[model samples]
Target: MSNNVLKNLKPYEVFKYFEEITQIPRGSGNEKGISDYLVAFAKEHNLEVIQDEALNVIIKKPGTAGYEGAPTIVLQGHMDMVNEKNQGTEHDFDKDPLKLRVEGDMLYATGTTLGADNGIAMAYAMALLASKDIAHPPVEALMTTDEEAGMSGAMALNPEHINGRILINIDSEEEGKLLVSCAGGVRVSVTLPIKWEDIKEDKTPIVIRLRGLKGGHSGMEIHKGRGNSNKIMGRILYDLQDRVSYNLCSLNGGAKNNAIPREADAVLLVNKEDVEGLKAVASSWNEVLKNELKASDPDVNVQVEVLPDRYNKMFSKETTKKAVQLLYLIPSGIQTMSMEIAGLVQSSTNLGVVTTSKDMITYDSATRSSVKTLKEDLVNQFKLLAEVVGVECETRADYPDWQYDADSKIRRVFERVYKEMTGNDPEIVAIHAGVECGLFKEKFGEMDMISFGPNLYDVHTPDEHISISSTERMWNYLIAVLKEIK
Candidate 1:
């Protein structure tokens, strides 16, 4: 099944390895199977290997004949991929392999994410390791797990296990750009206790839904000014407060802290007499939002539907007010841009997930900044907001930023190789998105690193895909760089 799709692809060895990888279920936090596969590959090739408790794999290969005395080079990429699928996709990420297909110059999965972000890097590394002809220094292929959820695998890796002074990170998304630096970040989770009472006899139950937003990676597309469904839903509820009396029953939306919320829905009990008024308010906002977000979210939708039976219970008036206020006030997009690097986002927060249960309503937010102080300040802001709303707040998955190195030799080598291969100099820039390189820098201060990869679009979402021709070019560029390394 995989052969027919990849038969015409160049760098045949790399694509073969990639197809094999796609068959294994390697979603973040579920990487034991892929980790074992790497171990087996290393053994099959008679290479030295280490499998850590965190499931990070390190495979070592001696240098080629003439380059035996050269410095060891580390090729790094994460083993796990973000698990995302379309609304009605039936494939299970835990056991089913990605359904692969080719479209023009790009490769994608049917109704799901393609996982080419870092999987291609793993394929490149494996192909290089299995080669007997490509010239290179001592190679260390480091594969870490759970990079999408957090940098857990990289955080747990011991610096002593690696001796390489030069590292090439293959986890970037662009085709002709080199990622020199990235933001540090942390996840903040807030829980607010809800006080619920039986629904009043004179009230009616209705559901308000905000959908059709074109959501993307929070850090990558936050500056695009797309509508956040959770935030929009909050605005509708807050605005309706003055015209209609409603008690919150349930509010839920979004799935991950890294992806923007594409849809959100809320259930409420409203005075029977004000049902039509609430629907009118929702319709009015729908038009306003469509106009406001037409450029970035042309398909923005706001819908209100009445329920046949009333909800058994709803939040008390005070709790409802607090919930609405918190949603309205929490920061949801780019907060500031970089002063040092023009057009770069310096600090931001994403209101990623919102959910409500009988006992509590919880919000999950992700905050990021290239500056440590600014990152802390953004986190503090969330903490203060949660405190004001009388909710419990905690932060987790804190990772450091990968600072730019002006004197990096590896960056220069990659730039030179890229120019020679494509007749154009690669753009060197920092990204707002978080990468495992940050954690690697924190662990190994002496390591000089740069990140580059083939073109991948819409990562962390169902529209994800990789450019086939770009992958071939990147493969040749990497081989050239390896041969030039001293």
Candidate 2:
């Protein structure tokens, strides 16, 4: 705390805790360091805390004065962040603390993702628990883990551990907007078998790369019209089926199953006589992609690079056809829009990751839909594709969507108090992205929850940043809401 980047910022305790925790790496599936740090912080403050097997931390504080009898208000947020960085970023999510930079009104991490999506929730909960003057009810801080990758932490939380009926999730992006409902989601992966054979004719190995697209959170930015590298690569190869003689050796791209893939590459063994023809297609395809994505992703690039080393094995013709067919046939991007809520995406899928192995190639996708039937329909579509293409498809982390509650007490309290404080009504809406709230709802059936936070932009991307002024505003609003609850 001696030379903290955000030590002097307003709401000193919140920023102070935020900086301290940022010093600990808390990427998805690697949460022990930060989880232990949280337990230590709770002990330092003398709060009752519980650390579960999944590294989910729950710290309990008794209500202040007359509010001791008030129902427990759960302050919930995940502990892990999506570990995403720029291609040339010189930072490690495993050990390095985020390099903080404050610009005008926004706070960003240089070349890496700032963990403010849910880290701010921890900071706010810490401030609430540590405050001596602020009034509040019995507070339970439910800090789970691995939310960006999946809802495993939240799913593993024991229901008997919580006595809170009112849950205020501080994981939303916009400050003044209250998220009442969110789309449910599941992670689906398709593994296709590939047959390898020795190349008979001498062929030139060339790598076709697609990059520079503005990739983002699949659910949040799916309607943005950004290019999906995996899908685009499939289209390229499919197009070349007639013009060139080639066999795919390997194709891979993307890191996370929930983030839109920004870059992808495919290695092809082309006949020596057809090398120029493949390069010609690559050049023409590059222009086509640029023109199509000019408004949404102007920097989109597609290039072919000649490999110096030679590849001995190439995918069999039958295997290659199945692979390209599976990639091109899979459904992606916006599928449906809400009729009740204008401009809201109701159903969508993201082709997030592509990888090749010794005998199989896998494609991972995240499917989100607010409607249960629609979500099921989307998964069935993939299953049908797998049946036709002769591949294996599996789904996991299936969570339901949170439905709207008309008599939400916590929401009313927030709306009324926020209006009184800012002289304007906060925007009330539902998001297409998945949050832990849905899983919590499944765990506690009677849970009444609302999700909101400060202004965060470009989540799950290296350009992610949070608004400074919005944080201060949110802090004040949360404090007021806690006091008013009783």
Candidate 3:
């Protein structure tokens, strides 16, 4: 229970469990280790536990003596964390544990994500399930998988597995806000055919590297005007087509579909005479990008890497043109703002990834919208663009938006408890990002749901961290809410 990184932290039990879970790598599409660990913890406490085929773990505990007949309460959160780090940081998310560090009131991972998004949820659930003094109704801890890239884990849930009508989802980022509605999203990918050609004797290869932009959660921070390196790479190529003759080898950027692209690298083969000119152009463009992003992404830059030896391969001129065209023509960033709510974004898209393979190039985008028709419209818009450029488009891991519930009993309990404890009313909010509450509503219409969490900043990015004092307040609030539910 005592660790140097978070030693003697308030709310000892929650931090203890959080530190333990951080030692195990739980990145998206890789939840077996964390899931099994949850099962072990449940068994150690002599509690009933079930793990589904998709690696979603559910642990059940009976109610206290006084609340044996109270309706069951379901606590849920995702198991996966967005795996991101500083470009040069040496850490493998699949195997290495997050290196925890404390800075004042914040908890951080050295040069990487801290996984506080939902890891704190698991920590809180573990603390509650193992405690002998807390008063509450029967508890069902639902830990799902792959909520970072997609909501596949939540979508794969079986109705029979969840018996609780009142659900508390501990996945919100803000401490005092209760989320009532959320935007639905889909992952759309476009694949284009490529033709590789041998390096020509007269060509010179130089890599254009884009870096230093502050990429963030596409849903949470899309309105901040942060640069998308994939889009910038496309813009550079499209603009330089008239000044220099070149063929592209590859255009790759981004690590996750739900995060804005922070850096991109593109290789180009140009006429030997145009190499110097290209470098000059890159320098000017770098300055331009910095100036434009002074407020949003001040460190934005572009570097030209000239190798001592000639490159071995390059894409054919036809394939190069098609690839550049796709990058240039496709749209990204916030698409539309909500007219109903002030300062709310209605629809947006993040062109998060671009990768080159042996025979094809793929562009992955995460599109979100609170309105079903608008979500369909944006996905269809991407497909139309793909059709024009002779590329294939496909959608996967789609999830429904959670609508606001005005008559939610769980929400009323939260609102009352939070006010009684804080002497102020908690803010009722509708988020643009997706949450599992929407999927649960689809599966169980009568279920009452609400989401709240500690203060987490810069999620889905390397700068992610959680507040220490906020965690204590959240823990106290959760216990108070649970006791009131009975």
- What are the lDDT figures for the candidates, one per model? 0.89, 0.90, 0.89
Candidate 3 accuracy as TM-score: 0.75
| Best lDDT among the predictions, by candidate number | 2
Which residues of candidate 2, in runs, are more than 4 Å off?
1-48, 62-69, 79-119, 130-133, 146-152, 201-208, 243-246, 267-283, 301-312, 397-400, 403-407, 455-472
Q: Write the per-residue lDDT of candidate 1 for residues 1-486, one digit (tens) a residue.
A: 254567678889999999988989999999999999999999999999999999999999999989989999999999999889999999999999998899999999888888897899899999999999999999999999888876789989999999998999998888888998899988988888999888658788889989899988888888898888888888998998888888998999888878899999999888878889888998898789989998999999888899897467889999999999988988878888887667898889999999998699999998988888889898888889888878888999788988777899999998888888878999988999788888888899888999999999988888999999999988998999999986
Each model's total of backbone clashes: 0, 0, 0
Q: Considering summed lDDT, which 10 consecutive residues are worst modelled in model 2? A: 1-10
TM per model? Answer: 0.82, 0.80, 0.75
1-486, model 3: which lDDT tens digit per residue?
224577679899999999988888999999999999999999999999999999999999999989889999999998999889999999999999889988999999888999998899999999999999999999999999998876788888888998999899999999889987788889999999888888758788789999999999899899899999999999998888888888998889999989999999998988879999998887689778988999999888899988666778889988989999989877798888877556778889999999988888999999998777888999999999999888899999788777666678888999999999999999988888988888898788788889999999998788999999999999999999989877
Error of 1 at 248 (Å): 3.0
RMSD of each: 4.1, 4.4, 5.2
Q: Pick the candidate with the highest TM-score.
A: 1
Q: lDDT by residue for model 2 over 1-486, one digit each (tens)?
A: 324888768889998888887778899999999899889989999999999999999999999999989889999998999889999889878988888888988889899899997899999999898899999999999999988877789988999999999999999888789999889988899999889999888889999999899899898788899999999999999999889978899989888978999999999998888888899998688789989999999999898988998888999988888888988988989999988667889999999999999999999999999887899999999998998887899998788888677789999999999899999999889889877888888789999999989999998899999888899999999989998877
Query: Considering TM-score, where higher is better, how would the candidates rank from best to worst?
Result: 1, 2, 3
Instruction: lDDT for model 2, please.
Output: 0.90
Say which prediction, candidate 2 or candidate 3, comes out ahead on lDDT. Answer: 2
